[model samples]
Target chain A: MTVGILFDMTKCIGCGACADACKEQNKLPGPVEEVTTAYTWTTVEAREGQYVRHLCMHCLVPTCASVCPVAALHKTPEGPVVYDADKCMGCRYCMMACPFDVPKYQWDRAIPIIGKCIMCTSRVKQGEATACATACPAEATVFGSRADMLKEAKERIRKEPDKYIDHVYGLKEAGGTGVLMISGVPFEKMGLKAKLTDEPPAMRTWQVLSNIPDFVAVWGVFLYGVHWITARRDTVAHHEAARKGPDTIDTTHTGRPS
Target chain B: MNSTATLPAGRFRLGFWTTVFALLTIPFLAITFLRFSKGLGAVTNLSDKFPWGLWIGFDLLCGVGLAAGAFTLTAVVHLFNLKRFEPIVRPTILTGFLGYIFVILALMFDLGQPWRIWHTIIYWNPHSVMFEVGWCVMLYTTVLSLEFAPVVLERFGFHAPVRMIHRLITPLVIAGVILSTLHQSSLGTLYLIVPSKLHPLWYSQLLPLFFYISAIGAGIGMVILESYMSKRAFGRHLEMDLLEPLARAMVVALGIYGLMRIQVIVRNGSYADVLNLTYEGKMFLLEFVLGVLLPVGLLAFRKLRTSPTWLVVGAFSAVLGFVVNRLNVSVTGMERASGIRYVPSVMEVIVSVTLIGIGMAAFALAVRYLKIFPEEKPAEEPEPEGS
Candidate 1:
């Protein structure tokens, strides 16, 4: 039930077919010469020595899902982080929270919706392959259950040790992502960061804010008590002073007792 | 009863809404049109990278921060029971109420879907700091209104409810102060989520503490500014007898804020960022100098505290400094991850201009109609008995 994609960059021929098919299937505008909304969900970024396809990794514990205040972006039980435009208030809290910056805004629109890949969940439910997996002329991309794809990725690296790099990207990055990658070049050289910690970015802030309610409640009671005691003392002192005439009364012993 | 108490019984003042204020509203109206019709993108230079802009930076952040004057004064006068400062209580509360009204107005503009603002209640995300800030702000606004209601009722010649409300004002004022304190600190806590994104100098775990302390300093600065302006505009005497003691408190407040800020800097080992030759570094120095150092130095002097001109100058500087700090957090400090820089277009500036224009005009109207200033005492009256 847990399906995923394995994009092996060592075998890709840098063809624009997969990207083209994605645009058509998703009803996006046709591809431009450079990557943009009209064409670019699957972008081919030029690394130092290789070209890497960039798209949402569809993380297991999606940072995008955790940060969306209105729950516009979410993780489905099947595993892809999907965007629900109807619920989107477009506050863009997810943008700041995402380390990879996958979700893009349609800035040109009068009323824009956040845009991100949904892992072709519709095709998966229909028991068909994704457009990119189906259209790959070189068999560069493979689609199957995450466990199966992961096993195949490790087996390929093991059989031909020198042909592929000794690393599997996205297997455990950001608390393990759904999409796995086997690249000939190092991930850092492929313009993909391998430095992100397993901890979701929003937790640090939540931890601090969670402590406030308790503090505020305690502080509120303390301040109210102080206000009461002070006011009552003033009232008593005022009554005491009123009993004495102004001519002989001393002002020093006024509010509160001497 | 004086002629003033009977309500000015003549034609409305013709020049009441100044030409400048009217002119400012034109852009505001137009910007509002584009905002609703074309959406937030049309009216603001806001990107996903910068979700908040000038309205939040100026009106809600600095405005509410400055409005801290009300609670600070109320706490000093009512809690500490400093009888000499009683004349300022009503005016301070009025300013706080108006400032809060402006805050709600600003929020309305900044919201991407203003219609769904009510969803904060229906879909309450208890873990979200924003949920806390939203509820706190709404509750505090209510507290301020109730704390200020007696003043309005007193003017309308309603004595019974006024007396009943008077009994609750003391507790209401305390509740209002506590709520304000929570939200004001939480405002800074909102930014703590983006530690890596915020500039090192501005980003710290101590953000909440710094925000709370700076608000108090800004609030005192606002009081000084208000007292000075009233003296010039209404020909009222500057209340230095009260302000002299207040200036001493401000000195201590600013001193604590300054030390705490430096302590944070040192603890983060980002103290070197202050001396770093980067744009963020320069801005940090400017925030430190104008917001904390210069104001503290001026207020510390007894002679400066007594002089209306120096006090006003110090206060204005502090206010400007607080505004800069907010802008730095919201706009200037966010490093460009998208490789795009944000510059507010004319429409964005127009909407911001309108909000400020309306706030000023509304403030002027309140001053004219609400009996905001305390009535001047008789020339040769005997000294009133003290409590």
Candidate 2:
């Protein structure tokens, strides 16, 4: 159904209620704070009294999913990019691949795994909104289908053109993320840095690696051809030397006819 | 058989490097214990922001690149039938085999769940760049072993298998070359997904090409450096005839790499903001100049390329600069997006050096026991047929 989130930064009240609800709902051990971690999946970054809640952007073609060796991080059909700790071999490549720097890690443990918002996949599957979205004191965080959220985001921007910046944060960044954000202030001013190509990063890898099979065939044939040609010449040279008398041909150390 | 064949001639010499190596290894063993027992957090400075460190950068990336001489020289001698270069084929293959082993060993420490590394084979995420690199490395390591098997088999008098390997040698080397090319470039593909995170100076569509070309240069440099060290340590006479042509070839390789790098940087027009002095700019300049331009210049001249001392100097510079290049790509290249710098811990340094020490010791052991160098005969008239 392509479920997604529409975070209206203008409506946010800079309260820690959403963060607290995320901690409670996810059963996270540590208290919620400005920075996220293994325990904290969501947090609010406040700049000049303007609040921007930080969590996974849940990209359409997630770089983390493409970079993972074991396919631990996967994007559900409904839209959340979820991580499986059981399948995770602790490469931490997802942590590096995320453009928004979303995924956090359990660096304190003997065996570490990454942490990030999964958009409450279990609850969302059961037709319930995310913990953070539901606990919002105001209608700042809205959960709906991606098409609906995108329509609402564009409508809000069009209705009050002067009141809002003429940009949707996740609409095109990193190849169109599932979560959309509209802010009164410029998104970058709220410390939400996400300047990237509209195309997914996975395409960048494939652009080069896709040529491998063709290269293998071409290179293999070229090498064999050279081997055959040189071997034939060496054989013919040996035959020519063998035709001469034993006293005439000097072939010691050559492993050829004497 | 002489004692030198059975054991290293200076078995009990216990030189200063030996003592230094021992000192580093003892602490490294202790650190490895803490790393496994207490976790990576106890010994490494790695965090969520900096997941990979010295182990992946130096040990895996640079280690693999430096060992490129194996496939490169093997193809030259076997596929192209360059008979003059035959003496170095085995040594390069041995170096390549040892380098992959070291990479696997380093991964045991870096992987979060080292035991599940094999899970990639079964899970099969073809979309993942790591998946492709993983399969290529595993397959290539196998190919390298088979390519090297004849040497070991011949040493131990296993003739039947040696003959079998001889028949299989051409195909084995071809497979090795293909696999090497795939993973070497795929290693660069790992960083392609981080275009936003990596500095534009290092990130580009042509990263794989740059990686493959630089690997060829690095491989040539490593062979030169290794040959010099072996000659110095084992008292084997240098093969001037072979090295002179090798130096000429290295110059061409480095020149090609440098040209491509310049074209990429100019096309990106990304690092043009060099007026504002930054650490990234400095590192970029260092890597480009010393690693590419300086070495190319050194080996271009006929006089310098022919002289063993000058050739070795150029090779050493290229190797050291290429090592820094890998570090720059992995760690320094991401400094802007990360907004944090990662310096290796003392324990990390100790472990890396100790691993290198172990690899060198293994190489030395092989050289002493195996027929690594061509047998040297005294320059004299042939013995009488009666004798």
Candidate 3:
């Protein structure tokens, strides 16, 4: 039921229509930018003699969403990773954590917030294709249910093995992003992070964070146990000193009187 | 120096260093105003490619790490029942409290929306490492305040509150240690999300453990340095007997940290990267040599550990190493992947320096007014001549 986009680089004609439609749909200002910025949500770049679109990958388990201390960025059930500016304290942790370097900051504004593509969640929710997908004259970018889009991408590669690369870039990178890409050129040559682990990065941090309760429990008991044993030892030593003659001083104990 | 010592106790004096700090504060204030009015882009060299810079690297990471002495000493004195260490406890706690305060102050500038900092308390994101760090820091600062409260309360003759706090002292110390452990390690966990982005030289699954162990070494080093400085400034007797044992502890910490660093590099099969002699490789070597090998090798010998001069040198080297290591993780390790050569702006450096000056000034004021030292002797002797 989750919506998604599959961008076929081979079909992209370097027309820049998707970029224009994105700017217009988002109400962004001015001519289309050559690269993604806080104001520009998406950009089409020339790489390896082909057009490659750059924007938020909107991962299945978004590192940006997980790293956000204020829950400003989160994955919607419908498929997109959305951002809430009101909840954001502008820590910029999202910008730091995003694997794709997707999140951009309004760094010039006095009251800045994070800016990134939200996967056109409003249009996707209305059962319509994203602005870029709708405007793709060559059918380079297509929107559909995630399951269907993934299957279609697989089918395309299987049907024309020699024409397409044998890989889907987002199918496993950063634990599988919602925006999948099938390219005729090798992903690495096209400037993609081709060697990222299949596992989500958030899980690495979670592996440590999940142990907090156990650590607190054991560490607390151990500290208290040490305190108790030492306190008893001090008391016993004090009593032994008392039993000894006044002339025999206990130089071993330097602790203050409890 | 002798004339200032002749002045009445509990009176603040404007010394040469104090005047220098005041002069430094002027630029910091102006830059701070410009920062807020024009935004972070105007004052810092940060970009979309490099979101963090010197502020997070030095001001927050190194500041918090150096302050780890407070928890370590408290646990040693209170939990382990080693009362010989009780003398330095109050000052360490004061340093920690002030260090955290300045960290929060630095954060106020780094954050694009400083006013909503409290949103961490309101908003819930248990999955976030930053959330855990935020909660632990907030709670630990409160714990530190309560631990140090007795010193202030007793000064003002607030006997009842002091006694009540004394009753709760053990629990407070325990809480402080627990909170410090969580956040100190969690700071490393913040980098876990950047496994690929951070260079292989610094990145490891054992980052949290590495951070924790190194913090212990730096904490002990800070204690040594603080004692030496206190002796020079106030003509206080050097606790050579106590510092000798702490030096030994520093040796053990550094040894463990060094061993772990090697183990990680070997396990990752990245020893070749260490010998690659690239920028990151050289920085890593520098960090290891300065932070670990030199300090450990210097302090491991009984003859050197017992010597005050050598002990101070080893401690300073270790502290410097810690700063370098943190910067390596925050800036150097990330440079190539970010594709931007990030050098902090002048205003950024000034802000960081001013924060340190403020911390030092605050410590001086506390030493003057508060009963930081157990043996209350007036500053009758002349200050020491050399560093």
Best by DockQ: 3
Each prediction's TM-score versus the true structure: 0.87, 0.95, 0.96
Candidates 1 and 2, the one with greater DockQ:
2
- Write candidate 2's Cα lDDT for B1-387 as tens digits: 111323364565677777889888879889988887777888888887788889988999998899899999988888877777888888889999999988988888888778889988888788888898889879999998888888888888999998998888899888888888888888888899988888888887778878888898989899989988877666555566787788777788888888877788778886673445478878988887778877888889988887778888899888888998899999999877887899999988888888888898888888878877666554522222211
State the lDDT of candidate 3 residue by residue for A121-235, as single tens digits.
8998899999999999998899998888899999999999998999988989999999999999999888787668899999999999899999999988999998988887888
Q: Of 1 and 3, which scores higher on lDDT?
A: 3
Kindly report which residue stretches of model 1 are placed more than 4 angstroms away from their true locations once superposed: A1-12, A29-42, A59-61, A121-176, A179-197, A239-258, B1-17, B336-338, B378-387
- Sorted by DockQ (best first), the order is 3, 2, 1
Model 3 Cα lDDT, one tens digit per residue, B74-124: 999999988888888888898889989989989999999999999999999
Model number with the top lDDT = 3
Clashes of each: 0, 0, 0
Better of 1 and 2 by TM-score: 2
True contacts kept of each: 0.29, 0.68, 0.76
Q: How high is the TM-score of chain A in each model?
A: 0.84, 0.92, 0.95
Candidate 2 chain A TM is 0.92
Measured on C-alpha atoms, candidate 3 has an lDDT of 0.88
- Residue A197 of model 2, lDDT score: 83
DockQ of each: 0.39, 0.61, 0.77
Q: What does DockQ come to for candidate 2?
A: 0.61
Error of 3 at B192 (Å): 1.1
Candidate 1, A200-229: lDDT as tens digits: 555766777667768778877887777777
